[model samples]
Target chain A: MAESVSEVRAWVNQRRGEGRTIGLVPTMGFLHDGHLSLVKRAKAAGHAVVMSIFVNPLQFGPGEDYDRYPRDIARDRKLAERTGVDLLFTPSVEEMYPRALQVTLRVGDLANRLCGLSRPGHFDGVATVVAKLFHIVEPDEAFFGEKDYQQLRIIQTMVEDLNLPVKVIGCPTVREADGLAMSSRNRYLSPEERRRAAVLSRALFDAARRCREGTTRAAELVQSVTQQLSSAGLEVEYVSAVREEDLGQVDQIDQPCRLLAAVRVGETRLIDNVALEAGKGMGHVSAYVDR
Target chain B: MAESVSEVRAWVNQRRGEGRTIGLVPTMGFLHDGHLSLVKRAKAAGHAVVMSIFVNPLQFGPGEDYDRYPRDIARDRKLAERTGVDLLFTPSVEEMYPRALQVTLRVGDLANRLCGLSRPGHFDGVATVVAKLFHIVEPDEAFFGEKDYQQLRIIQTMVEDLNLPVKVIGCPTVREADGLAMSSRNRYLSPEERRRAAVLSRALFDAARRCREGTTRAAELVQSVTQQLSSAGLEVEYVSAVREEDLGQVDQIDQPCRLLAAVRVGETRLIDNVALEAGKGMGHVSAYVDR
Candidate 1:
């Protein structure tokens, strides 16, 4: 495990000197099964896997959890090593951003939808830090969880636009046994809220199933998901059926799309999405909790 | 000379296969001696030099002469080949931006002062295009003229912040025998305005001399330069003494500073700057005009 940029560079250079391809998996710590799964996929690609655990303050908005983002270095280090990670990089805020950061990398309208609609400047922060990491790590391939569906899309677009050499691979979202998406923030939920939090993913899965069964109207699908979360004692922030490519909201499902929802169960915000294929029986939805 | 990205990449890979270091010099065409001088520096670095001539629309605001920007592919190709350039990449706007540019790389306060204050979003465009070039070229070193001092500083800061592997080397500003700074825009000047354009460099020279001779007050130095240009039949846009690193306008010349000035000679806009060391002598002034 290395905590400094110079040390990581030395390590990466030594590997590159031997012509070994490198892979990177960037995470905000509190290592979940989802992150470990990305590490496994990265390793499977004949890459020397490097995982970075940085709870980037740049990605958090004001009044958001910049200060209190969950971090446990000891626990994270153990899990990362157990997952066969070749190197674990845990950099402090000062290490990553030595000075006040003024430079920004931003995506266009893609950043103005779904989660971005509420958490303004969130994707910009994600794009900037990931860009910095991509340069510093110089990995041949980078793995990201499709759990952050919007983030994955933004990163893909950025790499293509900038002509960055690294390939971006998105692994499927890792979920819990109760059909809840695995997230670090799940730890913030109370026992009661944790049980209710599963409703977010349940709603996405159910809506995706409906879309696959010819529920093509965007308004009807959104309203149904919104009502489902509300009935489950969650406050729905947005229920969107957005095109997979540009993230533009689709009026009718004529092509592949994503059914995404963000809900607040108590003070903890949770988001989940499932891909929807046009017409009956083609889409794959995660297991749904029966009422 | 390669006009496409894939061809350039293949060439770059061939060179890297032999373990030769690569250098890049990016320009908007109509090659001048200033650009050739950078090629010499790049060659001197023992690098296989690659030059890109792209008149990026992203950098030009509406009505900002993007259409009129000078370009001569035949002449430029000849000049570049004569200078030992291994590859010349002249990508069309469509090749460079296949889609509408929805991603931007921005350097904040550093970009908002001096030239940026007059030309909003200009530096952002420069930053974005350069970033894309850096990734595509993957050069070991990139050469830039100090003639665009603020731009050079912005690129340096962006490289540092983004952890880009390439070294950004700023060569001293190249000038003509008449003391006018070398620029593609200089061709826009009429013969009389061309003669007057030298005043921009002269004022910067005089201001730098004054600073070296214990003229510490920024206002006094700016006033002297502004008056000099005004008397020389040039429309003074801004005369500023700024810190060399951050591009911050300094109220007093207690530190190493840059004396920057912009002027309009008829319809042509020209800018020039000189580094000021706070002591006697040892500064190179472009030309005295000897009127």
Candidate 2:
């Protein structure tokens, strides 16, 4: 485990000297299955896996969860080591940003959609910190979970736009047996809210299944998912269907699109998404749901 | 000259394999002594020097000189080879930005003063393209002239803020025989304007001399420089003395500071700057002015 930028940089330099390819998996801590899956994927793809555990303050809003964001270095370190992560970087916030970062990175209209609607500047913060991580690690490829679909898309676009030398690989979202997508914020849920959150994933899978059954209208799919969350007493923020490639709007889904939703179950906000092609049901739905 | 990004990237990779350190000199064509000096400095410091000649469209304003920006590729190629540049990258704008670039990078307040004040969104465009060049070239050190002092500071700050791997080197401003700073836009000047523009460099030097003679007030230096430009039949835009490092306002010049001025000699906008320590009268004034 490296706690300083210079230390991790020296380690990376040494690894690069040995001609080893590196993969980066960036996350806020608390060791969820989703983050671990990214680490496992990185290890499989690149010779060296470096997992960075940082609760980037830049990504959080004023009233957001920056202060209470879950963190457990001991648990995260163990999980990373078990998953064959070669380096675990946990730099302090001060170390990451000795002075305030004045440079702003925005992805235009792409960042103004989906999760970006309610969480303004969220993706910009994510993009900035992710860039910093990529530069520091100098990885050949970076791994991200499809659970945050919009985030995954924004990162992919940023890499392409800036011609960053890192390939962005989106791993499938890891989930729980009870049909709830794994998230560090899942720890904030009470027992009742935890059970209710299962509806979030179930709704997405059901919507994807419907799309496979020829309900190709994006509006119809969005309405179906929104109704399910509402029926389960969840406050639906947005249930959007956007073209999977660039997150562009999709009126009639002729190709692959994504069904994404953010809802409030009691006090915790939960998000889940699944890709829908006309003939393809949820690609890995069976892993999350009994059906 | 390597005309494609892939070609230059391949050449860079080959050099890295041989343990050669690379330096990058970015420029807009129309080879001048200013740009050649940067190439020479890069070759001296690093094992290999790569020069990129691209008139970046992103940095130009709507009514700016982008369309009329000078270009002489044949001459530029000869000069680059003559200076012993290891690689010359001259990628077309299309190759650099295949799609409309959506990622926007800005250097905040640092970009809102001086040239930035006159040219809104200009530095943002510069920061974005410079970042692209750095990523594509991956040079150990990148060179720029201090004639664009604000731009140099902004790039240096952006690099530190983003943890970019390249070291930014600021070389002294190259000057013409009669004390006119070398700029690609100098070709636009008429004979009279060309002769009169030497006043810009002269004013900066005179102000520096005054500071060294114990006139250490920033306001006094600014007034003296502005007076010199106004008397020379030139349109003075701004004359400011700021702390050399951050371009912060310097009320009392107890430490090193910079005197920057921008003006219009007929139709061409020319800018010049000089550094002033309490007793250092324009460290390189002997080269630019008749002392």
Candidate 3:
């Protein structure tokens, strides 16, 4: 049966009262193959899958593409039904945030680097809204894509530090053919910009290759990737290497490192990453690594 | 069956899997008769009460009595058992906040007025910790006392604004025979100071008398109470006549007004209030004249 957010919350509570497990897959309303994978994983884990479709305003920065973010509720609903989602919590902006949100959840130093530094207040918004959703959903386990590597790390830190009950399962980064990371924003790129956007993955691969070929310094790898993206006619926002788990700046490839990059192809921004581990005189590369 | 916090959380999740309703009552340990009243209210409302006892450090301002706060774990355990709490989450500060809590919950204008003005960051601390606790407990209904009227209002606003799953229930303020409001801080007062603290209620009652006896201007009532407390040798912090609901400052006593005061007698501080309709003129004086 079609359910409202409150109805699903009631259903979940009733099930919990009887001792049953619930799993949640949080998603923006433009359902694609990536979100379906999360739904499938949640259902297969023997949980009543609840998928929440909310484009959290806090996650979007001023002058960013919040207004243009792709959304298709009718299509998302059909897709959720097809994927066996037991409940779909599609709350309005007003329903999710009835008044101005005064409390903000931030992860300190971790949030001050990488995507957080570039987008300002982005992860704070992500952490706060996700924390609110976790409270509302009260799921035993929550699924997240590894494509948002920094987000995954920040959430893990939040859940651990805050002792939130839900178990965070990091799913593999779903990708398109040509090595492009699948995202709702991928739909916003023009065909020409789409082709140029492939450089995000290519640049990450090239940085990993250099790391494997004894390019140990992070600054060197970042410089090389920046040049490559610029040469590819893409406006590079940031191309840096950092510690794999914490996303902190690294001087050298002393341990596992993530080569992450973001670039704008025309008006569309794209992000991708590859993990590298230092070996004797060389490094080994892992494509689409989970933080 | 008796259970730990983790075990009870798991048990609650299991029931949620099957479908049930859960209620929560958050308390600092040393559960008193007032706390029990809240528990009984929860039980009567058909909620499986999950009571939490953690001396939240964030709520305490620097040099404002965090270390010397009363703690009686064994006694609290016995009280929880007696109150028939379904789950008693007694996490240490380390368990609830493993790392530094940088995020703060601010209630905007509401936080900067009244008790908030005297106790800077006090309600912010309350809001943040409560938001975190709300996430952890994920209760259907959460109960609080109107004794901390500002706190009750803040929590209610947080739940409504954040779209949290929990419903906030405000219970009436429990009090002592001499009319002093019940607070853990009451334990800090010297015997003489404790006795004199009753004057807080006395002064508010006097203000209410003035309001009912044709004194329509709030400033006049506030001035009279301030003089009364000052003459009693107590250092008055603030005495204001404000709106009963939002706690906003009012020029005239047309609506239901609250006469509130806080004073420091020796090293101890006390707060109290009384509600009266401001525009009732002399007819209302008999109803609240004597005690």
DockQ of each: 0.76, 0.82, 0.40
**Cα lDDT tens digits for candidate 2, B1-291:** 698878988999999989899999999889888889899899888559999999998899889899999999999999999998889999999988898876778788888788888999899988998998898999999999888889999999989999899999998888887778889999999998999999998888888788877889899899988988999999998999888777888899887788899999987899999887686644555325221
Please write out the lDDT profile of model 1 over residues B65-140, one tens digit for every residue: 9999988999999999999999999898888899986678977999878898788999999999999999999999
The candidate scoring highest on DockQ is: 2
Model number with the top lDDT: 1
User: What is the per-residue lDDT of model 3 for residues B127-237, given as tens digits with 9 covering 90 to 100?
Assistant: 878877776667888999766777887898777665576789987656677767777778888888888888877777677767777787888888989988998788998
Give residue B52's lDDT in candidate 1 (0 to 100).
99
CAPRI verdict (incorrect, acceptable, medium, high) for model 3: acceptable
Model 3 stretches with alpha carbons more than 4 Å out: A1-4, A11-20, A210-216, A280-291, B1-4, B7-23, B30-32, B43-50, B74-89, B102-106, B209-216, B242-245, B253-257, B278-291
Q: Write down the worst ten-residue block by lDDT for model 1 chain A.
A: A282-291
| Native-to-model Cα distance after best TM-score fit, residue A220 in candidate 1, in Å | 2.2
lDDT (Cα, tens digit) per residue for candidate 1, span A216-271: 89888899889989999999988899889899999998887888888888988888
Backbone clashes in candidate 1 total: 0
Q: What is the TM-score of chain B alone in each candidate?
A: 0.96, 0.96, 0.88
Q: Write the per-residue lDDT of candidate 2 for residues A55-95, one digit (tens) a residue.
A: 99999988988998888888888888988999999999998
Model 2's CAPRI class? Answer: high
Q: How many angstroms is residue A35 displaced in model 3 relative to the true structure, after the best TM-score fit?
A: 2.2
Off by over 4 Å in 1: A280-291, B282-291
